[model samples]
Target: QASLADLDILRRTRRMEYFRIVNWDNMLYPQYEDKMQKTIAPDIWKWLQSEAKRKLAEKPVAHPAVRAHWQSIVDGIVPFGYNVVEE
Candidate 1:
């Protein structure tokens, strides 16, 4: 029973290696940004971005300043020079 389990594990490992080799160059990603840029006008995109931000800002948070502070940290920049003061 133990030897059978070991053989099963080995077979699975070999199958995984074969799949990795086969899919080495089979990469794919959606060109959503390119498609949106080509289809949507620049001003429309900007308006969409502002609307999304407004929606995000409307969400309830215990500490709005702290929330924005941490979000700016995650974004690695203080967007629009908006200062976030810690409470």
Candidate 2:
């Protein structure tokens, strides 16, 4: 069956992981080569920044399932130098 639901998984998953990690900077990836006076389409990078901020603002502290998923994200981001809040 064809559906729009299954579509964009690649983009969605990619953005999800990117959001979990708060290191959105051109110094990190070449995706952002221009800024200020000039720029290109900022879809993925923008999605990450906006989505990350929107989510973390809620501070989801309930739901073990959500926590477990966030745990994996935290572990994955460890190499990037961002610390996760533990309680």
The TM-score of candidate 2 is 0.26
lDDT of 2: 0.43
lDDT by residue (tens digit), candidate 1, 1-87: 996676678678776321111232223535443322213334444444554465457755537785665455445454454333332
Whole-model lDDT per candidate:
0.46, 0.43
Count of residue pairs whose backbone atoms collide, per candidate: 0, 0
lDDT of 2 by residue, 20-59 (tens): 2223565566655432212223454344445444555566
Off by over 4 Å in 2: 1-41, 60-87
Query: Each prediction's TM-score against the native?
Result: 0.26, 0.26
> Candidate 1 lDDT (Cα, whole model)?
0.46
Look at candidate 1 and tell me the lDDT of residue 20: 12
